[model samples]
Target: MTDTTTTAPAHGVTISEAAADKVHRLLVQEGRDDLRLRVAVQPGGCSGLIYQLYFDERVLDGDAVVEFPAADGATVEVVVDRMSVPYLDDSKIDFEDSIEKQGFTIDNPNAQGSCACGDSFS
Candidate 1:
């Protein structure tokens, strides 16, 4: 289920509390509040498209910005470029910290098929 808190943005994408917490910790570690989590789709993965997730300080034109509340009461901003909106609309981002897996994961409903590595989508 998607986050329905007041901090949730009008943007279609939703970031789980766990993911927001992780992002918050990362930002604190870098001592930079200017960074925003940027999610973009780039070409050239095995399935023809790949996900690029990183912290960006720049806000380009036509970027969709969303603010999610972190565990510490601070807000974590998630940015998605206009071009990637269609590909990531309604997508949910989550963080898993388990023995089997440990990292951020994207549950994109728009993805018709993803590569075996889960790094690309068509």
Candidate 2:
């Protein structure tokens, strides 16, 4: 189940509490303070654009950041450029374990279609 208690920012985008917890768990396991999940929009994917998910230790000079405050009040930041923010607005990052899929997934509201392998998106 997703965490539903956290308040959304004035902006339309919001992250579920469950997603925040999952990110926090990963951050704790990684044992890195400088690392955060960097979500970005790239030129190619199955669709016209793709979402990049990775680790970053440094915040660029003018990068936009979306931070999900952990249940314990610690914050796990999700950095995405301003351009990508609109496409990913109200999107949530979730963790799942199943026979077919096991990892963090982007629950993006703006993605109309995804690649066959689910690596890229439009």
Candidate 3:
């Protein structure tokens, strides 16, 4: 029974409840309590930018953080670097576990267009 939600700055991206739950389970499976989910926009892919998501232990300077409380009583921290803030503003991270596709997805209102491969956006 920890705080239900801890959000980042107003302009920052958000994590959906399902995404938080999935992240919590993954973190538990990894057995590492020190890691945070890092989300970043990188320069690659068919479109102008690509999204990167991974577990990181380092809290680099200028990183924005948001915390979500999971059903398993774990607090999952999601981080985004300073450079990515603008591109990801008001975006959302979600998890899908369907038979056709299963993984984390981003819904970015800022994206003007996305690649057909679904790996990058401008």
Candidate 4:
């Protein structure tokens, strides 16, 4: 498969166009124009580390931000907390809508192994 990630060396994470489009639609559905997609790594999963993805309005201290231009002419901002940076570095967030699954997926190069459910990484 072709690489859809647009990784900026200065930034910790990247978002695919499909992911950006999905996020934009969700934001619009929630009527939250001021919110951003916050990605973080939290301790505790079947593996070792778990990924956390949510909509956040507050920009915490030392948060790394990256902007992606959506097909709708609007920009989507993705934020990652300082602590999660190392775990998510060079990671790509993608969206898939196949008959089997329909959701956001993370491609993390830093992960050595992941759980059977694919929710946690070691």
Candidate 5:
């Protein structure tokens, strides 16, 4: 961990645990190794920018990787950068398994508003 980077506590964010577990399970099912869940912000959502999450294998310099214990007792890591921290820091990621919806949703405290389509954020 870097000076400015820290991991979330076990009783911290709610969504993070589920997201980490889902990511871990996905990697395992896909037969992947050494992959990290990369979350970032890029311009072009309904708002000014949208959240981006994906499995990444490459680790860049200055990247902040947050490690959390999964439900299965494995450590899951999410890598972000200095720039994307403010938008994603302290944010919770959860999986929606309802019949009407099934995907990862972000609960970001920094987000002011999101687009109608749910692709962009203010």
Candidate 6:
């Protein structure tokens, strides 16, 4: 018999297993399979940049996509617009479910500093 090996996808950004699982659950609740987690950076925040995360049903031009496997054998897709690629490259997305914080966080190596509110980065 032949053996098969699986490798993680090489994406500009990566989502943690926890994040993927959460996304999968959200999608399941939404009852849609055409949705993708879209991440974008826009100019307008305490640090002059803000992050936008949402579920998208449409695909625009120059979009980069990466698929992650969920614990339930479902697949979660993440899409990054071309304009935000440079700022988000090599970044990691994780979900936190603790008393202190309960939300999605982005660990961006390119961010030099953030504002006092911790909502934006430079």
Model 4 ranges with Cα > 4 A deviation: 1-9
Model 5 pairs in collision: 15-93, 45-120, 46-120
* Candidate 5 lDDT trough over 10 residues, lowest sum: 3-12
Q: Kindly list the per-residue Cα lDDT of model 1 for residues 1-122, writing each as its tens digit.
A: 22324454545789999999999999999999999999999997889999999999988878878788898689898988889989898999999999999999999999999999998999
lDDT of 6 by residue, 1-122 (tens): 11112244334788999999999999889898889899999998989899899999877777777788887788788888889989998999999999999999999999999998777999
Between prediction 5 and prediction 6, the one with superior lDDT is 6
lDDT of 3 by residue, 21-118 (tens): 99988878888889988899999999989999999998787787778777667678888888998999989999999999999999999999999989
What TM-score do all the candidates reach, one by one?
0.92, 0.75, 0.90, 0.91, 0.84, 0.90
Clashes of each: 0, 2, 0, 0, 3, 0
Q: In lDDT terms, which candidate is top?
A: 1
Model 4 lDDT on a 0 to 1 scale: 0.85
The model with the greater lDDT, 1 or 6, is 1
Model 2, position 119: C-alpha lDDT score: 67
**Candidate 2 local accuracy as lDDT?**
0.70
Give the lDDT of residue 59 in candidate 2.
72
lDDT of 5 at 28: 86
lDDT of 2 at 70: 76
Could you tell me the lDDT of residue 121 within candidate 5?
A: 88
> Residue 52 in candidate 6 has what lDDT?
91
Taken over the whole model, the C-alpha lDDT of each candidate is 0.88, 0.70, 0.84, 0.85, 0.73, 0.84
Every model: Cα RMSD to truth: 3.9, 5.3, 3.5, 5.3, 3.3, 5.0
2 or 5, greater by TM-score: 5
Q: Candidate 1: which pairs clash?
A: none
Candidate 5 residue-wise lDDT at 91: 77
> By the lDDT metric, which is better: model 1 or model 3?
1
